[model samples]
Target: MTEEIIIAGFGGQGVLSMGKILAYSGIMQDQEVSWMPSYGPEMRGGTANVTVIISDNRISSPVLKKFDTAIILNQQSMDKFESDVKPGGTLLYDPNGITSHPERKDINIFKIPGAALAAEMGNPKTFNMIVLGAFLKVKPIVAIENVKKGLEKSLPERHHKLIPLNIEAIQKGMVNVESVNSI
Candidate 1:
């Protein structure tokens, strides 16, 4: 199985981190993985995006023009990457500051209110985990146990205490992800 994905959002939304976690999860699952990120200096408020590819066989390159899945966190990203999703692919987004929504009928569109859900969990940092969880639910490309291990590997020991919370946030995402459009 091969999944090429692009995750985009404003900086400070954990776009790169989420991609890294997903990459690590792929590693734990013994899959070939590639992760690449791009961001401006004004990361906190600027745009940030990452490309992650996971496959059962060898990976030729990290660069890609289209993706099988897109995780969009902000309106700008939604505008930018929505068209990049391949026909019959998945476009999962967080509908927080979005003024425009995905309109493509060829790809499947899913929404996870990560920001609001994170706020409801009383910890905004878990927003990315929630989003990741929604992605897992939709794809299940990587196992949850591997994802937990991936979290352990990505986070420093000092923050290991938050893994359980992150897992909870992921579960919330799994339950809350709503199908916006599917074709």
Candidate 2:
């Protein structure tokens, strides 16, 4: 099986890191994966995006014109990637940053209040993990055990203490995501 995903958000929202962790998790699962990131010069406040592909077999290319899933964190990304999702694909978004809702009849749409939830948890940095958790719950493309291992691999040793908190945020996301619509 192969899943092509695009995650887009404002910089400093952990967009790249989220994709990295997902890629690492795929690796831990013995799956072939590729992660590609794009960002503006402003970084922290500018837009950033990452494309990740996980496959059971060898990956042919990292670039993709369409995605199986699109995780959009802001209005701009929602506008840009909404049409990029393939028919019957999944579209996950954070409602806090969205001005308009997605309109699609062929794909599934879900909403995860990542930013708001992270703030409620008293750690804004966990927003991405929350979104990741929601994605995993909806797709189950990678195991949670592998995700924990991926977090260990992705985070520096000094930050290991925060792993549990991050995991908790992910769990919250899994439970909190709202199913907006389904095909």
Candidate 3:
């Protein structure tokens, strides 16, 4: 089955990074993938979002109408895309950013405190990784082993030591799986 996901947040919140990880992981898993980020005037502070499509077969369209899943890091994103998600689709929102609750009952919304959890992990920047972990548990597009390998390959050679910490952050997010489907 194919999966389409949108990762949305304000600038500097690593919205693109999460998309990159998803694309990289999909590549590692030998899946057809495409990552499309908003390119027009969103370069400013309006909204930054990326769409990642992973499929076992050839991808038909790069544009997505109903995302199978979403990771919203900011309130604007939550307000903007939560309603557009497909019924039964998953929504992972950063509680630190999103304030409003979704009124839709058809979609599964997981409000993950990724920013706070990353801060507790001693690296506030790892919020993207935390979100990745949650996606791993929910969508599971790629195996954890491939994800680790892709992550190691993506990082600079000099900063390879940070891989373990990223893995830890991922594991911590995974441990909170029960909260994922519920949130």
Candidate 4:
């Protein structure tokens, strides 16, 4: 299977790191993967986005005009990438910073209150992982074991102690995702 995904949000919200973890997970699962990241000048609160493609066979290129899934964390990203989801694809969003909801009818929409949940868990940094967990629950592109390996590979060795907490956040996200019929 081939999945082209775009994860977009503010720069400090772990958008790039999430893509990296996803790419690493694909690699651990023996899948061909590509990750491309983009961010505005401000870097912290400014817009950031990453495109990740995973496939079972050889990938011809990394560029993509549309995506099979779009993970939106904020209203700006929702505005930008909502229409980029392919018909019959998936659109996942975190409602914390979203001012406007996705308006597409051709795709499936899922809501994960990642930021709020992360805050409730007392670890705001786990928000992205929570969103990723929700995505995996909806579309098991890669196994959770591989995702754990991915997290280990992506995080610095000094921060290894947080893996369990991250895993807990992911589990919380998987259970809390809400399927929305429409915006």
True-structure lDDT of candidate 4: 0.90
C-alpha lDDT (0 to 100) for residue 88 of candidate 4 = 93
Mark the regions of model 4 whose C-alpha exceeds 4 Å error after superposition: 39-45
Give TM-scores for every candidate, taking all chains together and pairing residue i with residue i. 0.95, 0.95, 0.92, 0.94
- Note each model's CA RMSD in angstroms: 1.8, 1.9, 1.9, 2.1
Off-target runs (Cα >4 Å) in candidate 1 are 39-45
Tens digit per residue, CA lDDT, model 1, 8-95: 9977888899999999999999999999886444346588999999999999878888999999998888877899999999999998
Q: Distance (Å) between predicted and true CA of 15, model 3?
A: 1.3
Encode model 3's per-residue lDDT on 1-183: one tens digit a residue: 799988988878788877887788788989998989976565586688998998899998887778999888888887878887998888877778556866676777676678888888888888888888887887778998888888876778898888888888887777664344542
Candidate 2, superposed: residue stretches over 4 Å from native: 39-45
Report the C-alpha lDDT of model 4 over 13-118, residue by residue, as the tens digit.
9999999999999999999999988644434658899889999999976877799999999898888789889999999999886778887788999999999999
TM-score of 4: 0.94
The per-residue C-alpha lDDT of model 3 at residue 169 equals: 80
What TM-score should be assigned to candidate 2?
A: 0.95
